[model samples]
Target: MARRYDPDRRTRIIDAALRVIVADGIAGLSHRSVAAEADVPLGSTTYHFGSLDELLTAALRRSNENFAQALRDSEVCAGDADGGEGASSGARLADELTRVLGEWFAGERGAIELEYELYLAALRRPALRPVAAEWTTSAVELLSTRTDPATARALVALMDGVCLQVLLTGSAFDAEYTREMLTRVVDGCA
Candidate 1:
């Protein structure tokens, strides 16, 4: 019989792999574990992904897709706060931007933890480098729409740092507190 592609099975395995990665981190992922978690035959793991590195690459790509979509959704929801035509004036946009940034930092930490695992994996595998680089560039471009390139990059770094702080400290990194600091850095460039 000719080989057939089973998209659903592949997706199921990938989803299970993500859960495993989230719970145990990347180093703990294995085809056997993923198969058991996916409730598929061990052979099914090899059938879908030729090797462990390939499976991890797919999982990281999936993480990239999921995180990008989450940010897009957050942007849409936050945009609704912009009153109407003249709704978001100068200071308003800045405030709304900070609020949006806070919401993202609060809500997206889990995804970042997954990303942290993916990044560590990427360090060992060159094949995954493109995915990591593309994710970073795409994220920067998304931020650039709201601020200049330099400020956007800075904001990305700040968000990453603040999210890490919150994750490590188990406390909220209030955007309001960072607003003046970020605004000063952003406005300083002009």
Candidate 2:
């Protein structure tokens, strides 16, 4: 009798690849590793992803989509008050962003690390640049709803810097400090 095929095998392989990337970085990613992580045969990974680059691309795309969804689901700017630029609205935006960042750091720090790994990997691989670009573009688009394009771009950069600092220092994420910085940016944009 033939073996059963899992309909979600591709997704499982992609997710397992992300876990491997998070734990070992892109340098350690391989069909065998992902297969073991996913508890699937090695062939499954190769069948789903013909090469390591393809697997990395899929994993990065999945990771970006998951992070983007988390940002969207947080309703980061859903409470934006309609009217002229006011301190209250700016503060509200900052508070919302702070909350979102806090939650992300508290729960998704590993994923954030994986994201940075993929971003750095893109630096050497020209083909992977599009994945990183898409991730940045998505984040900026999400942020633009709360501020001007230039400020939104700055805020995204700020976010990356802060997250990297926290990750590197292994210190607790300072949401208040983030809020303060975000408020400064939002107020400046107003």
Name the best candidate (by lDDT).
2
TM-scores of all models?
A: 0.76, 0.87
Q: lDDT (0-100) at residue 80 of candidate 1?
A: 39
lDDT of 2 by residue, 12-118 (tens): 99999999988888878889999999999999898888888889888888878866787788766465655436457767777777887788887867788888788
- lDDT of the candidates, in the order given: 0.72, 0.83
lDDT of 2: 0.83
lDDT of 1 at 114: 84
CA shift of 154, model 2, Å: 1.1
- Residue 20, model 2: lDDT of 92
